[model samples]
Target: MTTPQLLMIEDDQRLAQMVVEYLAQSGFAVTHAGDGAGGMAALERQLPDLVILDLMLPDADGLELCRRIRALPGAAGKVPVLMLTAKGDPMDRIIGLELGADDYLPKPFEPRELLARIRAVLRRRGEGGLAGGAEPARGLRFGSLEIDRDARTVTVAGQAAELTSYQFDLLVAMAERAGRVLTRDQIMEAVRGRELEAFDRSIDVHMGRIRAAIEADPKNPKRILTVRGVGYVFAKQQD
Candidate 1:
């Protein structure tokens, strides 16, 4: 297996150094950037398997930086972002997610947890050969909407739809079971590949993002229907 490259944008040099050294032991080659601009420059230098972003930087607000990263062109824009929120604030975490972060870890966390989270996020992007011996699933289609599993791309009327790594996996999980009304737990479990102890409200945010990307009218979504009191169902048939 090839070592996964990582870019960590953090102002704390000591923490960054420790993380770099620790992750190196786990076969990840890390590149560190002290601020948002340096981080963006490093990103332009080479795309890594994942980016570890700090919510508070000396030169930029991490939320604005996250927006900028999402605004980048092509695949660079789609690179998975894992945010580190220093405040341990839930609202900050939610805003980061709204701005397209794939995941978040609060400050003063265990290195082991960080490693696990990194591996989990990377796996969602189909990195690190996480699928093992299983055959890759084929693409799915519903009228103008096309989901290419291999490319990890989604298109609406041949136009690309922007989706974060986790959102893409969530969509694929539902698309794989069209017409079946899956509860929130089911949706989470499907995307996670295992059972979750509690429901994640973030899935609703992801679903909204998906609708905005693929539906003509997000307010009246036809492709992904919300069955109140139950869950959501991917329309088996679409225009």
Candidate 2:
């Protein structure tokens, strides 16, 4: 197994050191950046397999940093991000997801749990997230919209769509079950292979982002439809 390269952007030196040491034992190659500027410089220098971002950086807001990361040109933009937030407000976590974080861990968390979450996110990326014993297909298509399972790319009318690794997985999860109304809990379970925890509303946030990428008009989506109080459905016949 290849050692995964991870870039951790955090200002808390003591906590950063502890995490670096812990993850090293698990065979991860972690690079620590003490501030947003340093983190962006590191990321520009070398693209990592994943980024561990802190919600509050000394020089920049973590949410803004995440948005910048997504805007980066080429492959640097699409790296998976696992956000670390110390705030007690669930809004911070929700906003992190909205801004393209692949996952989030509350501070004061067990190192073991963080390790587990990291592995889960990476595994989902590698396996194409079709984890329920289903044979992997080549790809899925809907008219001008195409999802290439192998390349993990989505293109609308030949134009590449910007989707995070996690967002791509979420789209595939729904496309695999096209035309079916998926409840938020069902969507969460499909993507994460686990149910949401206590009133988690990140699903809506992510879906909105997904629509903005794939839909011609996000305000009036045709491919993915909201079903009133039910949930959402991927249109069976899309243009």
Candidate 3:
């Protein structure tokens, strides 16, 4: 089996080197970037199997980087991402996860724990059996909104809606299980291959964005609805 290609984006030189060494030793083909620019550059040159991203980078923020990574075309869309940050705030973790990170690791972490997280992410993603391509054949329709699973495209009242790969994936996952209360953890598992961190409400943010694109009125959304103490549910269009 091929070693997993991993990109480590961290501004701290010592920590970056240590992570690179540890990951490499753990059977990952690792590349280290000291700044956001370099990290993005590395991504453009060749996409890795996974990315270990630091939240505070010199040139760009980690959340934006996660969005960019998920926006990449074709096979790159399915590559899992593990975010690293010193910030232990739940909000920060939620935002990172919302931006399409597969997992999050607080700073001053053990290499072993990070490795375990990475393994879990990979396993979850792999177990899904979701092959990269356009959308699948399954589709869910509600009023003007039609989600083509095979095409991986969404249409609002017949006009195609432009969505990032991550956004499209999130929509399809929720729509497929419409009406079922999917907790953030379950949604994370199905959509991004990970769980939400405490204070990480990024999922809510992304869902809001999705509502804006799909709902006639985001504030009074008719499609995606919140499930108190659980997660969110995609509502079927009312007759």
lDDT of 3 by residue, 1-239 (tens): 98888889899999988878888898988898998889888988988778889999988988988887877664333577889999989889777756667567898999888888787666544433233444545767877788776565688988766554456677877876778888877776666534434333656766876887788788988889988888899886542
lDDT score, residue 62, model 2?
Answer: 95
Q: Give the range of the ten consecutive residues with the poorest summed lDDT in model 3.
A: 124-133
Kindly report which residue stretches of model 3 are placed more than 4 angstroms away from their true locations once superposed.
63-79, 98-100, 127-170, 184-203
Task: Please name the candidate that would achieve the greatest TM-score relative to the true structure.
Answer: 2
Candidate 1 residue pairs in backbone clash: none
* TM-score of decoy 2: 0.93
lDDT of 3 at 190: 68
lDDT tens digits, residue span 1-239, model 2: 88999999999999999999999999999999999999999989988889999999889999999998987776532589999988979888888988889888889889988888888788778888765986867988999999999889999999988888888988999999999999887887777734324344777888898999999999999999999898999999987
Residue 141 local lDDT, model 3: 80
- RMSD in angstroms between candidate 3 and the native structure over all alpha carbons: 4.7
CA shift at 46, candidate 2, in angstroms? 1.2
lDDT values, one for every candidate: 0.83, 0.87, 0.74
**Regarding TM-score, does 2 or 3 come out ahead?**
2
Model 3, residue 147: distance off in Å is: 4.6
For candidate 1, the lDDT comes to 0.83
Report how far off residue 55 is in candidate 2 (Å). Answer: 1.4
Which lDDT value does model 1 have at 15?
A: 98
